[model samples]
Target chain A: MFTISLVGPPNSGKTTLFNKLSGQKIKTVNYPGATVDYFSADFDKKYEINAHLIDTPGIISLIPTSIDEIITIEGIYSHPEFGTPDLIITTIDASQLSRHLILVNDLIEANFNVVVIITMNDILARKNFSIDENKLSEELNLPVFKIDLTKDNGIDELIHFIKTEVENNFEKRVINKISEDTFTLVNKYNRISEIEKKVLFPTKTNSKNITKDFNNLHKPDEISLKIDSVLLNGTWGLLIFFLAMSVTFASVFWLASPIMDLIDSAFALSSESILGIWGNNWFTQLLANGLIAGFGSVAVFIPQILILFLILGILEDTGYLARGAMLVDKPLSKIGLNGRSFAPMVSGFACAVPAIMAARTIPNKRERLLTIFILPLLSCSARIPVYLLLIGFLVPTTGSLTAGIILASIYLLSIISSLVAAGIINKLKNKVITEQDHSSFILELPTYKIPRLNNVFFNAYLSTKSYITGAGPIIMIFSVILWALTFFPAGIDNSIYNENDSFEQELIENSYASNIGKFLEPAVSPLGVDWRVGVAIITSFAAREVFVSSMALMFQVNISDEDSIQKSLLKNMQKAKKSDGTKVFTTSSIIGLIVFFIIAMQCVSTLAITKKETGSWRIPILQFFIYTFSAYFLAVISVNLINFFGIA
Target chain B: MKVRNASQLLNGEQSEILGIDYNHPSARRIIEVGFTPGEEIKVIGKSLFDDPIAFSIRGTVIAIRKSEASSIIIR
Candidate 1:
């Protein structure tokens, strides 16, 4: 298979072009050991042999400043041991060809056998800018293909070109000494300029058309000044960030309610049907109380996850994310971080896995690692269920809205704490890792286009499907284990336990006699949690959502109906007392628990990703320990502080 | 000397390209995006941020820092 590398600046439609030519839609993955993004596709052309196309990250220069740029440069230079690219297909937006020619020139100088793919030809046509293809080819001494990627024009021609070149082993010499002796060359020949002038001509006949059409493209300076005006001085930017965040949370809660209720009712119906068929056997009891309840708990939160992703996807696609990054950059810089860290941190609110993955964009190793380290501190969607359950139990119904406000406040507090912790860590550490000069933020604010519905729904479906299939089994198994832990040590008579209550409750009340609960009782007592909560916490380490299942199994409750489970948990927590005769979930313990969850490293998926991204287990392991310890210490302090103040 | 801010250059506006301050953040960004001093830059459009603007320079629609745009003294 022949390799063709597609290179261009960000938002130059390189990925769009790759999609058109290869007919493959793959998520761009960050190159390991570099912040640059790339995607590889195997193209099977009709006339041409199968070719491998590498879509490289955007770069403006051969000498790169940003991590992504550096990666692109390295990818270009580092000839793969297995295979080096046989041909390079450089894509440039035709309407903006002037800026793109730099990369073309650099590639030419690098001596790569190159072909230029100029995209957005329609835009050029509208602007009355005509590219004399033959003239350009003669001037540059290379093949040039122009297309509109969105319209899928010129793709077949491109494929045909690739096939022919690869088969014939076609080679073309590129100018490699543009900078080496350009001073002498400029003085000696001025010949290069003469050639350029002859080849490049502006059409004056349709100058009005050109001006009218050019209004469609964004001018970088005006946009920057506007952003500076708002971000640097105006309060509107901050207000927008806060307002958007508020709406996000509100939508998450509102959109999720109906789906959550449906899931609850479905699970409740299943439990009731199972109980009727099984007639109260231990196995039936386990199925009803442990397995069904456990899965149902986590499954209910799926709606919230879906809603959050939808909002974020829209914001990202609309190019508002870049503005948000710009808005937050100064505040972040004050704390020794930069604007690049904002995306990953925001992503952490959904799930830490992608947030950690997104950290690759940060460029600096220390900043990336620090961002990864503190990401778990953000109150991810996983913690929402725990918060809702606890807050509903403790706060009065009349002021539930105020309780929700408090929950939101705590999430903000967590972010602030994480930033503070990152700063402290940066200062305390003696290690001197070089930080990349901040790449002047020059993100292309892609024209505001209504997000494609097909793209949004397709992404949402794939994400939800993966979560259900990939993470579902682990949750089920954990539920079963939790059931066995509380269910085993068969009583002298199976009928010896109270007959009125369900088997689940019988097992928990008598759990001391059960082998598993007895084993965990000693270790969890210090945190003011019974062995039951400890077991849930441990199972949750696999995935925070599994806590719901663990809780259901531990409690031996078949309350699969969401409302029932909420009510039961609230009732149980309210009734239970510590050894000292105070309520177990006193105000302090609740705060402490929330704080613990805020700082705790609970998701295994995040750790796995960190290991993959860092190419080492050391960082993930270190992260786990640091976060776990932080959670424990903070929980202890919070509990004591609440007690000290007599708030409990 | 005619000094016009880059933002003022309408699409299809033809002017003598002068010099660029490569050290200026926006100027460096403009250059990085393939906009060199003396290169003809065509005004593109505006985005929400109103800075980090995009333009057609050297045959590519490159975005540069707005701060850099101020340094491009075009006649």
Candidate 2:
């Protein structure tokens, strides 16, 4: 099969042309290596070409400084599994012709079957400039096609040309590896300048101001500079960045909640109706509570994931994300992270799974790993319910102000902890192994363009789909395991239930999960929580948000309405007592539980994603054990310290 | 004609590139992005902390750290 790969410099409209050609709904993120989408699609019959098109990450020169560039270079010159691509489609931005042509020169030197597709000709034309296509083609000794990607001008001619080339089945071109030393690069740049002088012409000229006009012509667009003046200003830029982030995050929560609640209720209703019909057999239990529940766990995250990517897509498309990264780069660098780490870390506040996936954009492997390692420590929205419930118990009658302050403090603490952890881990890793790949911050602030809505939606949909397919199965399997742990050792007799003990409570008390909790009572007792809270902790390992529902079940709170689940759970928790007649959910114990939830790596979905992104189980396994134990130890210490202070 | 590292150019100041500090780690990429000798570059903007400065080169805006910009000698 003839494979044609699309290669180009960053912000050269390569992916846009690829999308137009293949009619595929792949997203185009601007940052190199940020997106792992290497889409290969068959040509449409309308094009009359039996060829496969591979869209690689946007890259500059063949001498790769980053992973994305390396991938692009590899895809064209030497793919491991598929050898060299038969034809390389190098997209050059006509607006930045001279610099972009350097890549074309490198490809020509390497003797690849190169087809130059000049994109952004319309942008160039708008600047009162035009490229002489025939002269460019003659100089490059290749078929050069200039097409306006925005308006789809000259596309049919390019398509027909490609079709003819493919049909001819031209002789294989042998790779001639060129020396990429500094001298060669200089020569290539010099050569590109000569070609530019020959083929580029002024569309509208004034002889009187030719020199000034020529100098100013190469400056960046007026609108982008104007917007950047306000947006990249030291104070206004950071302020707008925070405001934009808050809006995105607030939308992720608020916009996704309605859909999430609908999904939650839908799953709950399905389980209840199934129980009503099946009359409570083990099969029904597995179907409704285990299988269905697992599916719901996976489905529940779709809204947040979609909403996050959608906003990110818009931000990325508008070219503001690059500026946002530049704004945060200095602060993040103090902790051994760079600008690229900002997006993923902020996304971690929504959920760690997608946040880890977003870490793919950081070109440096060590920095990427550090970002992923500390991401789960961020106070994600999933822990909000647990925090709220615990905060209520800790200070039952306090006004909303104090509770809000406590919640904010918890968030602040999580952020501080992540930063400190990153600093320490980075130091440790550097000491253990010297890294040669120095992280560099060379980012393009692409000209701002109004985001195309279809493109933004497609990006969101593709990313959400990938997350479901990538981490969905592991979440489902683990959800079933958790279900089985709580569901098994079944048929604890109805007769075993006392007057005060509900059948649900009796069943839970006799389940394997409860047994594990009983076994861990000695370990948890120091933290002032009993076997029941221990069971809640174990059940919530599937997801931190499960703590509230698991606690309701353990306490037999009989929450008939969703609105009052918290109120009833709190009331039951406040009254619940141990065998020694001491009350559970005391102030110190609740604080400990809150701290535990804040720090513990309890979400199986996060673990699954960490495993997927890192392509290894060793890191996830180590992350799980290290985080959970530290959370426990910290909880114990907090509880003891609080008690010693007479806070109880 | 006086020459200084590109990092020394004040914001909104324009200069023609003299050459790159070849020993710097990121020199190759900087040169590849049209920071070669004789190219015109303008310091368009500076970040909040003024470390990673944004420059307009080849009709596109790019941001690089002061450390990397220091390698690009210009006047």
Candidate 3:
């Protein structure tokens, strides 16, 4: 099949154009030899064009500064897998033609079949300026499609152009010698300036024109300047940034909770119905606890992920994210990260996998690594259930102001820990990689526009889909394996059970997981938790949310509904005794558990993604051991200190 | 005209870029984004600490940290 690629600078509407052209939700995969996502899709048959289309990462020049740029430039000249593209459509922002043309000139000079598509025409028209497309096409000597995908205008002409002209008439051009010397860039800009002088004109000839003749076409966008005046004001801007972040986080936590509860109940109901019908057999147990519960853990996170991305999408579309980055850049740079790390860290609050992927935006490899390394300590939503469980044992009133304060403090602790960890890692990694230091922070503040709701929703849906597909199967498989670990070696005699002992409890006590937990009891004893909590901690290494299910199995809380399940678990936890006949869950022990969950690198999926993004197992392996050891050491110290203070 | 680092220009000040400091690592990147010699740039906004100053260049607003922006010599 024929292949075509869409290349452009960032904020050039290239991805939107690709979506409009392909008219489908596309799949994203890691580009060869890089973790940056590359979007590729086949053109819809309704267009009658059967070519493969690639939406490449945005870049300013052929000279690579970031991993994303390296992939885009390499993909254009020679992709090891897809080979070279038959045609490259370089999309340029009409208003920023001088800067955007640098890429087009490079592509044309390299002897590729380059076609120019001018975007942001409406923005130019608003500024009372317009490009003479015919003159531009003549000057560039390539096909120019001046379609406005936003209003669905000129698309038919573009489709017809591709259908009739691009079918087989394009010559097979060889890649020429590519040079990124200073003179070549200067010459390209000079040529672009000459062309701009000939083609640019005031939109209305009779009115007071902003342009001084045609030679100088540089007019700063007044609208953007006006908006930035208020939004980027030094004092007011920081306040607004924090307010916006708080609202987004609050909505994600509050708005998604009710829907999440509904999903939780739905999953629990199905699992219970299957068990009730199938009558307590091993098959029913596996289907309910192993399959349904595993699937439920993945499904329940959809609402929070969707809401977070939706708000982030709106902020991104309005061009506020860049400004937000600027607001936070100074403080972030103090910790060895730049403004770009802000967005990814905020995303980490929802899920670390997407957040790790988001770190591709950071151009500096060390900063990106530092950002990824601290992400797990940021209290991802998966830790919410575990925190709630332990907090319930600590706070008598579940919904009291004290409980809220405690919950918020735990989140605050996670945030503070991540920042501290980032600072430490940054200092350490800098020494090792000082020879190849490329720590630079350059950001573009795109003009603000009304957010397109369709695009925002589409992106939210896409991210939610990716999270499910990425983490779903692993959770399911691990839940089944965990089920087997806690279920088997069922040869215990009925006489071993006391009058109060439940059958499920006896089975779990006799299982291999219990043996392992008992084996690990000595190691965790200083944290003031028992062997049951030890088993739960070990089982949760697959994913943090598994701690809740493991806790339920360990306590033998067989309730189906959500509230009753928690209440029963709390009741069991409160009454449970240690091997010395003392209370197992004192205030000190709960504090220890909370601290451990906050710092431990428990999720296998996160480690897998870290390896994928960093392109090595060394960091992930180091991250796991370091975080785990520190978590345990800190937990032991915190438990002892709290005990010494006589809090419980 | 006297030359100074672009980072020294206050908000609302406009200047013509003289050349990039070749010793700086991000000199090429600043030049690639239309901050070449003779290009007119205006400081449009500044963040809290005035570290990452935003400038309007070629009709586009770009923000660069002061450490990197200092590489662009402007008059």
Worst 10 residues of 1 chain A by lDDT: A180-189
Point to the candidate with the largest TM-score: 3
Candidate 2 residue lDDT tens string, A1-648:
777888888888887888788844333322232334567677765676787787787777878765555656766687654567888888998889988998888888888889999988878878787899999999999999988887999899888878877878668878987676986788778888888878888877654665565576688999999999888888888999899987787677679877977887788778778977775556777788788977876787788778888888899899998999999888887777889998888778767877887787777777777788899999876786688788888667634778867977898899988998778777786652234367778888999999988879976787777667765786678677877777777643434434443666767777998889999999888988789988888888877776766787788876354645567788889799987999887889988998898889998878877876676787788778878998989999999999999986
lDDT string for model 1 (A8-53, tens) is 7666677667666664445443454632245666664443456677
- Which docking band does candidate 3 fall into? medium
What C-alpha lDDT, on a 0 to 100 scale, does residue A532 get in candidate 3? 97
lDDT of 2 at A605: 76
TM-score of each model, paired residue for residue? 0.77, 0.92, 0.95
lDDT of 3 at A365: 82
Listed in order, the DockQ scores are 0.20, 0.82, 0.76
C-alpha positional error of residue A481 in candidate 3 after TM-score superposition, expressed in Å: 1.4
Better of 2 and 3 by lDDT: 3
Better of 1 and 2 by TM-score: 2
Off by over 4 Å in 1: A23-49, A52-56, A61-82, A125-128, A170-233, A260-303, A396-399, A429-448, A453-502, A505-529, A558-563, A579-581, B1-31, B39-75
User: How many residue pairs clash (N, CA or C atoms closer than 3 angstroms) in each of the candidate models, in the order given?
Assistant: 32, 1, 0
Candidate 3 local lDDT, A81-197, one digit each (tens): 566888887889988888998888888888887778898898778767799889999999988878786797878777786776457655677788678677556667877877976
Which candidate would rank higher by DockQ, 1 or 2?
2
> What would the C-alpha RMSD of candidate 3 be, to one decimal place?
2.5
